[model samples]
Target: MSNVLPRAAALAAAALLATTGALVGATQSSALPMAPTCRVADLELAVGGPQRAGGAIDYPILFTNTTGHNCALRGYPGVSVTDARHRQIGTSAIRTGEPISTVLVAPDETVTAVMRTNSRSVAPNCRPKSTYVKVYPPNSGVAEEISYALRVCGMFEISPVEAAD
Candidate 1:
Protein backbone atom coordinates (compact mmCIF):
# COMPACT_ATOMS: atom_id res chain seq x y z
CA MET A 1 0.00 0.00 0.00
CA SER A 2 2.83 2.44 0.82
CA ASN A 3 4.57 1.81 -2.55
CA VAL A 4 1.29 2.32 -4.47
CA LEU A 5 0.95 5.94 -3.23
CA PRO A 6 4.40 7.03 -4.59
CA ARG A 7 3.82 5.40 -8.01
CA ALA A 8 0.38 7.01 -8.50
CA ALA A 9 1.75 10.45 -7.54
CA ALA A 10 4.55 10.19 -10.12
CA LEU A 11 2.11 9.20 -12.87
CA ALA A 12 -0.12 12.16 -12.15
CA ALA A 13 2.84 14.53 -12.32
CA ALA A 14 3.94 13.12 -15.67
CA ALA A 15 0.43 13.48 -17.12
CA LEU A 16 0.25 17.13 -16.03
CA LEU A 17 3.60 17.95 -17.63
CA ALA A 18 2.57 16.39 -20.96
CA THR A 19 -0.63 18.43 -21.05
CA THR A 20 1.25 21.68 -20.40
CA GLY A 21 3.75 20.94 -23.14
CA ALA A 22 1.01 20.35 -25.71
CA LEU A 23 -0.66 23.64 -24.84
CA VAL A 24 2.59 25.53 -25.29
CA GLY A 25 3.16 24.01 -28.71
CA ALA A 26 -0.33 24.92 -29.88
CA THR A 27 0.10 28.55 -28.85
CA GLN A 28 3.41 28.89 -30.61
CA SER A 29 2.05 27.47 -33.87
CA SER A 30 -0.90 29.87 -33.90
CA ALA A 31 1.18 33.00 -33.43
CA LEU A 32 1.33 34.67 -36.84
CA PRO A 33 2.16 38.35 -37.08
CA MET A 34 -0.65 40.58 -38.34
CA ALA A 35 -0.25 42.26 -41.74
CA PRO A 36 1.08 45.81 -41.61
CA THR A 37 -1.15 48.63 -42.80
CA CYS A 38 0.28 50.49 -45.80
CA ARG A 39 -2.58 52.95 -45.77
CA VAL A 40 -6.10 53.38 -44.48
CA ALA A 41 -7.81 51.50 -47.29
CA ASP A 42 -9.86 48.42 -48.01
CA LEU A 43 -9.75 46.17 -51.07
CA GLU A 44 -11.85 43.19 -52.11
CA LEU A 45 -12.30 40.76 -55.00
CA ALA A 46 -15.55 39.58 -56.59
CA VAL A 47 -15.64 36.78 -59.12
CA GLY A 48 -18.59 36.33 -61.43
CA GLY A 49 -19.86 32.98 -62.73
CA PRO A 50 -17.32 30.69 -64.32
CA GLN A 51 -17.12 30.21 -68.08
CA ARG A 52 -15.68 27.31 -70.03
CA ALA A 53 -12.20 27.25 -71.48
CA GLY A 54 -11.67 29.80 -74.27
CA GLY A 55 -14.63 31.66 -72.82
CA ALA A 56 -14.85 34.88 -70.89
CA ILE A 57 -16.02 35.77 -67.38
CA ASP A 58 -16.30 39.20 -65.85
CA TYR A 59 -14.23 39.75 -62.70
CA PRO A 60 -14.58 42.92 -60.70
CA ILE A 61 -11.94 44.08 -58.25
CA LEU A 62 -13.00 46.78 -55.85
CA PHE A 63 -10.76 48.92 -53.70
CA THR A 64 -11.09 52.03 -51.61
CA ASN A 65 -7.86 53.96 -51.15
CA THR A 66 -8.56 56.22 -48.19
CA THR A 67 -5.18 57.64 -47.31
CA GLY A 68 -4.60 61.31 -47.92
CA HIS A 69 -1.62 60.47 -50.11
CA ASN A 70 -2.28 58.99 -53.52
CA CYS A 71 -1.22 55.36 -54.02
CA ALA A 72 -0.17 53.67 -57.22
CA LEU A 73 -2.30 50.82 -58.48
CA ARG A 74 0.60 48.63 -59.51
CA GLY A 75 -0.70 45.26 -60.67
CA TYR A 76 -2.24 42.02 -59.64
CA PRO A 77 -0.64 40.43 -56.60
CA GLY A 78 -0.67 36.69 -57.30
CA VAL A 79 -3.54 34.43 -58.28
CA SER A 80 -3.34 30.66 -58.21
CA VAL A 81 -5.58 27.63 -58.22
CA THR A 82 -4.68 24.35 -56.58
CA ASP A 83 -6.02 20.87 -57.14
CA ALA A 84 -7.08 18.27 -54.61
CA ARG A 85 -3.46 17.21 -54.20
CA HIS A 86 -2.57 20.77 -53.26
CA ARG A 87 -0.62 21.15 -56.47
CA GLN A 88 -0.84 24.43 -58.29
CA ILE A 89 -2.60 23.88 -61.57
CA GLY A 90 -3.39 27.41 -62.64
CA THR A 91 -1.67 30.75 -62.28
CA SER A 92 -3.40 34.05 -63.09
CA ALA A 93 -2.07 37.50 -63.84
CA ILE A 94 -3.70 40.88 -63.91
CA ARG A 95 -4.68 42.07 -67.35
CA THR A 96 -4.61 45.80 -67.27
CA GLY A 97 -6.19 48.22 -69.72
CA GLU A 98 -5.02 48.58 -73.32
CA PRO A 99 -2.51 51.29 -72.46
CA ILE A 100 -1.64 49.49 -69.18
CA SER A 101 -2.02 52.67 -67.21
CA THR A 102 -1.31 53.00 -63.51
CA VAL A 103 -4.24 53.85 -61.24
CA LEU A 104 -3.63 56.61 -58.78
CA VAL A 105 -6.40 56.18 -56.24
CA ALA A 106 -6.56 59.45 -54.37
CA PRO A 107 -7.48 59.73 -50.73
CA ASP A 108 -11.09 58.79 -49.98
CA GLU A 109 -11.49 57.61 -53.54
CA THR A 110 -13.36 54.45 -54.44
CA VAL A 111 -12.35 52.54 -57.53
CA THR A 112 -13.52 49.46 -59.38
CA ALA A 113 -11.52 47.64 -62.01
CA VAL A 114 -13.10 45.14 -64.37
CA MET A 115 -11.07 42.37 -65.98
CA ARG A 116 -11.99 39.35 -68.03
CA THR A 117 -10.40 36.02 -67.30
CA ASN A 118 -8.64 34.26 -70.14
CA SER A 119 -10.49 31.05 -69.46
CA ARG A 120 -8.33 29.09 -71.88
CA SER A 121 -5.23 30.07 -69.97
CA VAL A 122 -6.31 30.14 -66.34
CA ALA A 123 -9.20 27.74 -65.92
CA PRO A 124 -9.92 24.97 -68.39
CA ASN A 125 -12.84 23.02 -67.01
CA CYS A 126 -14.11 25.99 -65.04
CA ARG A 127 -14.80 23.59 -62.20
CA PRO A 128 -14.83 24.42 -58.56
CA LYS A 129 -11.32 24.72 -57.15
CA SER A 130 -9.32 26.33 -54.40
CA THR A 131 -8.25 29.81 -55.46
CA TYR A 132 -5.93 32.28 -53.80
CA VAL A 133 -5.97 36.02 -54.55
CA LYS A 134 -3.25 38.34 -53.38
CA VAL A 135 -2.43 42.03 -53.80
CA TYR A 136 1.18 43.13 -53.82
CA PRO A 137 3.58 45.55 -55.42
CA PRO A 138 4.02 45.18 -59.14
CA ASN A 139 6.37 42.36 -60.16
CA SER A 140 6.73 41.15 -56.58
CA GLY A 141 5.80 37.96 -54.77
CA VAL A 142 2.78 37.96 -52.51
CA ALA A 143 4.90 37.09 -49.51
CA GLU A 144 7.38 39.80 -50.37
CA GLU A 145 4.80 42.56 -50.03
CA ILE A 146 5.72 44.49 -46.88
CA SER A 147 2.41 46.29 -46.64
CA TYR A 148 -0.49 43.85 -47.08
CA ALA A 149 -1.51 40.66 -48.89
CA LEU A 150 -5.04 39.51 -49.68
CA ARG A 151 -5.61 35.78 -49.95
CA VAL A 152 -8.88 33.98 -50.70
CA CYS A 153 -7.24 30.70 -49.60
CA GLY A 154 -10.19 28.36 -50.19
CA MET A 155 -12.93 27.09 -52.44
CA PHE A 156 -13.62 29.43 -55.37
CA GLU A 157 -15.96 28.45 -58.15
CA ILE A 158 -15.64 29.80 -61.63
CA SER A 159 -18.82 31.06 -63.31
CA PRO A 160 -21.45 28.50 -64.34
CA VAL A 161 -19.81 25.99 -61.95
CA GLU A 162 -20.74 23.37 -64.55
CA ALA A 163 -22.78 23.31 -67.73
CA ALA A 164 -25.26 20.94 -66.09
CA ASP A 165 -25.61 22.99 -62.94
Candidate 2:
Protein backbone atom coordinates (compact mmCIF):
# COMPACT_ATOMS: atom_id res chain seq x y z
CA MET A 1 0.00 0.00 0.00
CA SER A 2 3.02 2.35 -0.24
CA ASN A 3 2.97 5.33 -2.65
CA VAL A 4 6.10 4.01 -4.49
CA LEU A 5 4.35 0.72 -5.35
CA PRO A 6 1.27 2.51 -6.76
CA ARG A 7 3.37 4.91 -8.89
CA ALA A 8 5.47 2.10 -10.32
CA ALA A 9 2.37 0.06 -11.20
CA ALA A 10 0.78 3.02 -12.93
CA LEU A 11 3.87 3.60 -15.08
CA ALA A 12 4.01 -0.04 -16.05
CA ALA A 13 0.33 -0.03 -17.02
CA ALA A 14 0.84 3.06 -19.18
CA ALA A 15 3.76 1.47 -20.99
CA LEU A 16 1.75 -1.67 -21.71
CA LEU A 17 -1.14 0.35 -23.08
CA ALA A 18 1.17 2.31 -25.38
CA THR A 19 2.80 -0.84 -26.67
CA THR A 20 -0.58 -2.47 -27.35
CA GLY A 21 -1.74 0.60 -29.25
CA ALA A 22 1.32 0.58 -31.50
CA LEU A 23 0.84 -3.06 -32.38
CA VAL A 24 -2.85 -2.62 -33.07
CA GLY A 25 -2.19 0.34 -35.35
CA ALA A 26 0.45 -1.51 -37.29
CA THR A 27 -1.75 -4.54 -37.79
CA GLN A 28 -4.73 -2.53 -38.95
CA SER A 29 -2.74 -0.49 -41.44
CA SER A 30 -1.16 -3.62 -42.86
CA ALA A 31 -4.58 -5.12 -43.37
CA LEU A 32 -5.85 -2.04 -45.21
CA PRO A 33 -6.25 -2.45 -48.94
CA MET A 34 -4.31 -0.45 -51.48
CA ALA A 35 -5.80 1.40 -54.42
CA PRO A 36 -5.70 -0.25 -57.81
CA THR A 37 -3.88 1.12 -60.82
CA CYS A 38 -5.61 4.01 -62.53
CA ARG A 39 -7.37 3.24 -65.76
CA VAL A 40 -7.13 5.60 -68.76
CA ALA A 41 -10.88 5.75 -69.06
CA ASP A 42 -11.29 6.92 -65.49
CA LEU A 43 -8.79 9.76 -65.77
CA GLU A 44 -9.39 13.15 -67.33
CA LEU A 45 -6.33 14.61 -68.95
CA ALA A 46 -5.63 18.33 -69.24
CA VAL A 47 -2.63 20.39 -70.17
CA GLY A 48 -1.87 23.62 -68.37
CA GLY A 49 -0.57 26.71 -70.13
CA PRO A 50 2.98 26.26 -71.40
CA GLN A 51 5.78 28.13 -69.72
CA ARG A 52 8.95 29.00 -71.65
CA ALA A 53 12.20 29.32 -69.77
CA GLY A 54 15.90 28.62 -70.50
CA GLY A 55 15.03 28.11 -74.16
CA ALA A 56 12.86 25.18 -73.07
CA ILE A 57 9.09 24.88 -72.92
CA ASP A 58 7.62 22.99 -69.98
CA TYR A 59 4.09 21.68 -70.39
CA PRO A 60 2.31 20.62 -67.23
CA ILE A 61 0.11 17.69 -68.10
CA LEU A 62 -2.62 17.01 -65.57
CA PHE A 63 -4.33 13.69 -64.91
CA THR A 64 -7.45 13.96 -62.76
CA ASN A 65 -9.29 11.07 -61.24
CA THR A 66 -12.76 11.24 -62.71
CA THR A 67 -14.10 8.31 -60.77
CA GLY A 68 -15.33 8.27 -57.18
CA HIS A 69 -12.76 5.73 -56.00
CA ASN A 70 -9.02 6.14 -55.57
CA CYS A 71 -6.37 4.89 -57.98
CA ALA A 72 -2.62 4.86 -58.43
CA LEU A 73 -0.26 6.16 -61.09
CA ARG A 74 3.34 5.05 -61.29
CA GLY A 75 6.23 5.91 -63.60
CA TYR A 76 6.24 8.22 -66.61
CA PRO A 77 3.25 8.78 -68.84
CA GLY A 78 3.97 8.03 -72.50
CA VAL A 79 3.94 11.35 -74.38
CA SER A 80 4.19 11.86 -78.12
CA VAL A 81 3.28 14.39 -80.75
CA THR A 82 0.43 13.83 -83.12
CA ASP A 83 -1.34 15.41 -86.07
CA ALA A 84 -5.01 16.03 -86.87
CA ARG A 85 -5.46 12.33 -87.63
CA HIS A 86 -3.88 11.19 -84.32
CA ARG A 87 -0.77 9.82 -85.96
CA GLN A 88 2.27 9.55 -83.76
CA ILE A 89 4.85 11.99 -85.08
CA GLY A 90 7.97 10.98 -83.20
CA THR A 91 9.56 8.56 -80.76
CA SER A 92 8.01 8.22 -77.33
CA ALA A 93 9.16 10.67 -74.70
CA ILE A 94 12.42 10.01 -72.89
CA ARG A 95 12.26 9.92 -69.10
CA THR A 96 13.85 12.78 -67.24
CA GLY A 97 15.69 12.65 -63.91
CA GLU A 98 12.56 12.80 -61.80
CA PRO A 99 12.33 9.89 -59.39
CA ILE A 100 9.67 7.42 -60.39
CA SER A 101 7.17 6.51 -57.68
CA THR A 102 3.55 5.57 -57.21
CA VAL A 103 1.08 8.41 -56.75
CA LEU A 104 -2.27 7.74 -55.08
CA VAL A 105 -4.89 9.85 -56.80
CA ALA A 106 -8.09 10.51 -54.95
CA PRO A 107 -11.37 11.26 -56.66
CA ASP A 108 -11.27 14.68 -58.30
CA GLU A 109 -7.60 15.04 -57.37
CA THR A 110 -5.05 15.88 -60.03
CA VAL A 111 -1.48 14.78 -60.59
CA THR A 112 0.95 16.28 -63.08
CA ALA A 113 3.87 15.35 -65.29
CA VAL A 114 5.89 18.08 -66.95
CA MET A 115 6.94 17.72 -70.58
CA ARG A 116 10.03 19.69 -71.50
CA THR A 117 10.97 20.50 -75.05
CA ASN A 118 13.27 22.88 -76.83
CA SER A 119 11.57 26.14 -77.68
CA ARG A 120 10.72 26.70 -81.34
CA SER A 121 12.35 30.09 -81.09
CA VAL A 122 15.67 28.34 -80.57
CA ALA A 123 15.30 26.27 -83.77
CA PRO A 124 12.05 25.93 -85.65
CA ASN A 125 12.98 22.82 -87.59
CA CYS A 126 14.37 21.05 -84.55
CA ARG A 127 11.12 21.67 -82.72
CA PRO A 128 8.51 20.91 -85.32
CA LYS A 129 4.96 21.94 -84.53
CA SER A 130 2.37 19.35 -83.60
CA THR A 131 -1.38 19.74 -83.86
CA TYR A 132 -2.09 17.46 -80.95
CA VAL A 133 -0.39 15.52 -78.18
CA LYS A 134 -1.23 11.93 -77.39
CA VAL A 135 -0.76 11.04 -73.72
CA TYR A 136 -0.91 7.50 -72.43
CA PRO A 137 -1.20 7.30 -68.70
CA PRO A 138 1.40 5.08 -67.09
CA ASN A 139 0.85 1.47 -68.11
CA SER A 140 -2.06 2.39 -70.38
CA GLY A 141 -2.15 1.24 -73.99
CA VAL A 142 -4.97 3.58 -74.97
CA ALA A 143 -4.04 7.19 -75.56
CA GLU A 144 -5.90 10.43 -74.94
CA GLU A 145 -5.90 13.18 -77.57
CA ILE A 146 -5.19 16.51 -75.99
CA SER A 147 -5.17 19.76 -77.97
CA TYR A 148 -1.49 20.55 -77.64
CA ALA A 149 -0.52 22.61 -80.64
CA LEU A 150 3.15 23.24 -80.09
CA ARG A 151 6.68 22.51 -81.22
CA VAL A 152 7.15 19.33 -79.18
CA CYS A 153 10.27 18.38 -81.17
CA GLY A 154 9.96 14.63 -81.30
CA MET A 155 8.95 13.75 -77.75
CA PHE A 156 11.24 15.69 -75.52
CA GLU A 157 12.17 14.90 -71.92
CA ILE A 158 9.31 14.31 -69.49
CA SER A 159 9.09 13.61 -65.78
CA PRO A 160 7.05 10.98 -63.98
CA VAL A 161 3.64 11.65 -62.48
CA GLU A 162 3.66 13.53 -59.18
CA ALA A 163 1.48 15.69 -56.97
CA ALA A 164 0.12 18.62 -58.96
CA ASP A 165 1.21 21.00 -56.28
Candidate 3:
Protein backbone atom coordinates (compact mmCIF):
# COMPACT_ATOMS: atom_id res chain seq x y z
CA MET A 1 0.00 0.00 0.00
CA SER A 2 2.87 2.36 0.84
CA ASN A 3 4.57 1.66 -2.48
CA VAL A 4 1.31 2.31 -4.40
CA LEU A 5 0.74 5.61 -2.61
CA PRO A 6 4.21 6.94 -3.50
CA ARG A 7 3.82 5.92 -7.13
CA ALA A 8 0.41 7.61 -7.34
CA ALA A 9 1.78 10.80 -5.84
CA ALA A 10 4.59 10.87 -8.39
CA LEU A 11 2.13 10.47 -11.23
CA ALA A 12 -0.05 13.27 -9.91
CA ALA A 13 2.94 15.59 -9.66
CA ALA A 14 3.97 14.85 -13.22
CA ALA A 15 0.44 15.57 -14.50
CA LEU A 16 0.31 18.85 -12.63
CA LEU A 17 3.62 19.94 -14.14
CA ALA A 18 2.40 19.22 -17.63
CA THR A 19 -0.81 21.18 -17.15
CA THR A 20 1.09 24.13 -15.71
CA GLY A 21 3.50 24.16 -18.64
CA ALA A 22 0.60 24.45 -21.07
CA LEU A 23 -1.05 27.22 -19.10
CA VAL A 24 2.11 29.30 -18.98
CA GLY A 25 2.80 28.77 -22.66
CA ALA A 26 6.50 28.33 -22.19
CA THR A 27 8.43 28.86 -25.41
CA GLN A 28 10.84 26.04 -24.74
CA SER A 29 9.86 22.59 -25.94
CA SER A 30 8.45 20.59 -23.08
CA ALA A 31 8.83 16.82 -22.72
CA LEU A 32 5.65 16.72 -24.76
CA PRO A 33 6.50 18.19 -28.13
CA MET A 34 5.14 21.57 -29.11
CA ALA A 35 3.11 22.03 -32.26
CA PRO A 36 5.21 22.64 -35.35
CA THR A 37 5.42 26.08 -36.89
CA CYS A 38 2.79 26.71 -39.54
CA ARG A 39 3.91 26.23 -43.10
CA VAL A 40 2.96 28.54 -45.98
CA ALA A 41 1.24 25.73 -47.88
CA ASP A 42 -0.80 24.85 -44.81
CA LEU A 43 -2.44 28.26 -44.80
CA GLU A 44 -4.90 30.21 -46.89
CA LEU A 45 -3.88 33.83 -47.06
CA ALA A 46 -6.04 36.87 -47.67
CA VAL A 47 -5.75 40.61 -47.46
CA GLY A 48 -8.92 41.63 -45.70
CA GLY A 49 -10.76 44.86 -45.05
CA PRO A 50 -8.93 47.99 -46.04
CA GLN A 51 -10.68 50.31 -43.65
CA ARG A 52 -9.71 53.80 -44.71
CA ALA A 53 -10.14 56.37 -42.01
CA GLY A 54 -8.68 59.83 -41.75
CA GLY A 55 -5.08 59.88 -42.95
CA ALA A 56 -4.47 56.13 -42.75
CA ILE A 57 -5.36 53.02 -44.69
CA ASP A 58 -5.69 50.19 -42.20
CA TYR A 59 -6.21 46.50 -42.94
CA PRO A 60 -5.59 43.03 -41.70
CA ILE A 61 -3.61 40.28 -43.39
CA LEU A 62 -5.32 37.06 -42.48
CA PHE A 63 -3.89 33.54 -42.27
CA THR A 64 -6.28 30.62 -42.14
CA ASN A 65 -5.11 27.19 -41.11
CA THR A 66 -6.38 24.62 -43.58
CA THR A 67 -4.90 21.49 -42.04
CA GLY A 68 -6.59 19.26 -39.49
CA HIS A 69 -3.78 19.47 -36.96
CA ASN A 70 -2.88 22.45 -34.83
CA CYS A 71 0.15 24.53 -35.77
CA ALA A 72 2.11 27.27 -34.05
CA LEU A 73 2.80 30.81 -35.17
CA ARG A 74 5.12 33.30 -33.57
CA GLY A 75 6.74 36.59 -34.51
CA TYR A 76 5.86 38.64 -37.57
CA PRO A 77 5.09 37.37 -41.02
CA GLY A 78 7.27 38.78 -43.79
CA VAL A 79 5.19 41.16 -45.92
CA SER A 80 5.89 43.05 -49.09
CA VAL A 81 3.86 44.74 -51.75
CA THR A 82 4.16 43.22 -55.20
CA ASP A 83 3.06 44.14 -58.69
CA ALA A 84 0.98 42.13 -61.13
CA ARG A 85 4.11 40.46 -62.45
CA HIS A 86 4.99 39.36 -58.91
CA ARG A 87 7.84 41.80 -58.59
CA GLN A 88 8.36 43.43 -55.26
CA ILE A 89 7.23 47.03 -55.46
CA GLY A 90 8.67 48.37 -52.26
CA THR A 91 10.58 47.45 -49.16
CA SER A 92 9.10 44.80 -46.93
CA ALA A 93 6.62 45.95 -44.32
CA ILE A 94 8.15 47.11 -41.07
CA ARG A 95 7.07 45.27 -37.95
CA THR A 96 5.50 47.08 -35.03
CA GLY A 97 4.45 46.04 -31.54
CA GLU A 98 6.36 44.13 -28.89
CA PRO A 99 6.11 41.01 -26.81
CA ILE A 100 4.48 38.79 -29.38
CA SER A 101 2.99 35.56 -28.11
CA THR A 102 2.89 32.16 -29.76
CA VAL A 103 -0.49 31.29 -31.19
CA LEU A 104 -1.65 27.71 -31.70
CA VAL A 105 -4.01 27.67 -34.66
CA ALA A 106 -6.47 24.83 -35.09
CA PRO A 107 -8.09 23.66 -38.30
CA ASP A 108 -10.01 26.41 -40.11
CA GLU A 109 -9.00 28.93 -37.46
CA THR A 110 -7.64 32.26 -38.52
CA VAL A 111 -5.07 34.71 -37.24
CA THR A 112 -4.49 38.28 -38.35
CA ALA A 113 -1.88 41.01 -38.37
CA VAL A 114 -3.15 44.53 -38.59
CA MET A 115 -1.45 46.81 -41.10
CA ARG A 116 -1.19 50.56 -41.31
CA THR A 117 -0.12 52.46 -44.40
CA ASN A 118 -0.31 55.89 -45.97
CA SER A 119 -3.60 56.98 -47.46
CA ARG A 120 -3.88 58.16 -51.07
CA SER A 121 -4.50 61.61 -49.76
CA VAL A 122 -1.37 61.25 -47.69
CA ALA A 123 0.93 60.13 -50.53
CA PRO A 124 -0.17 61.04 -54.04
CA ASN A 125 2.35 59.42 -56.40
CA CYS A 126 3.15 55.95 -55.10
CA ARG A 127 1.50 54.94 -58.34
CA PRO A 128 1.39 51.97 -60.59
CA LYS A 129 -0.24 50.91 -57.41
CA SER A 130 0.70 47.63 -55.81
CA THR A 131 -1.51 44.75 -56.95
CA TYR A 132 -0.91 42.27 -54.19
CA VAL A 133 0.64 41.61 -50.85
CA LYS A 134 3.29 38.92 -50.70
CA VAL A 135 3.31 37.01 -47.47
CA TYR A 136 5.92 34.70 -46.03
CA PRO A 137 4.60 32.95 -43.00
CA PRO A 138 6.82 32.89 -39.94
CA ASN A 139 9.93 30.79 -40.43
CA SER A 140 8.81 29.78 -43.92
CA GLY A 141 10.98 30.19 -47.00
CA VAL A 142 8.06 29.92 -49.41
CA ALA A 143 5.57 32.76 -49.94
CA GLU A 144 1.86 33.23 -50.46
CA GLU A 145 0.28 35.87 -52.66
CA ILE A 146 -2.98 37.60 -51.82
CA SER A 147 -4.91 40.21 -53.74
CA TYR A 148 -4.30 43.78 -52.66
CA ALA A 149 -4.97 47.10 -54.33
CA LEU A 150 -3.34 50.06 -52.68
CA ARG A 151 -0.76 52.72 -53.35
CA VAL A 152 1.46 52.24 -50.38
CA CYS A 153 3.91 54.89 -49.24
CA GLY A 154 5.68 56.15 -46.17
CA MET A 155 6.19 53.71 -43.31
CA PHE A 156 4.16 50.57 -43.79
CA GLU A 157 3.88 48.99 -40.39
CA ILE A 158 2.41 45.63 -39.36
CA SER A 159 1.50 44.17 -36.01
CA PRO A 160 2.30 40.67 -34.82
CA VAL A 161 0.02 37.76 -35.58
CA GLU A 162 -2.89 37.54 -33.22
CA ALA A 163 -5.74 35.10 -32.88
CA ALA A 164 -9.00 36.22 -34.44
CA ASP A 165 -11.63 36.90 -31.85
Question: How many residue pairs clash in all the candidates, one count each?
Answer: 4, 0, 0
Ranking by TM-score: 3, 2, 1
Off by over 4 Å in 2: 1-33
List lDDT for all candidates, in order: 0.41, 0.83, 0.83
Q: lDDT score, residue 100, model 3? A: 85
Estimate, for each residue in 1-165, the C-alpha lDDT of model 2 and write its tens digit: 589998998888778778764333356434334789999889999888988787788999999999999999989999988878877777767999778888889999999999988776764666446788889999898888899786764338889999887
lDDT of 1 by residue, 107-156 (tens): 56555444345443454544343433333333344322112122222223
The TM-scores, one per candidate, come to 0.39, 0.76, 0.78
Deviation (Å) of 36 in candidate 3: 1.3
**lDDT (tens digit, per residue) of candidate 3 on 7-72:** 998888778778775533345543334688999988999988888878888888899999999898
The TM-score of candidate 2 is 0.76
For model 3 the TM-score comes to: 0.78
The best-first sequence of candidates by lDDT reads: 2, 3, 1
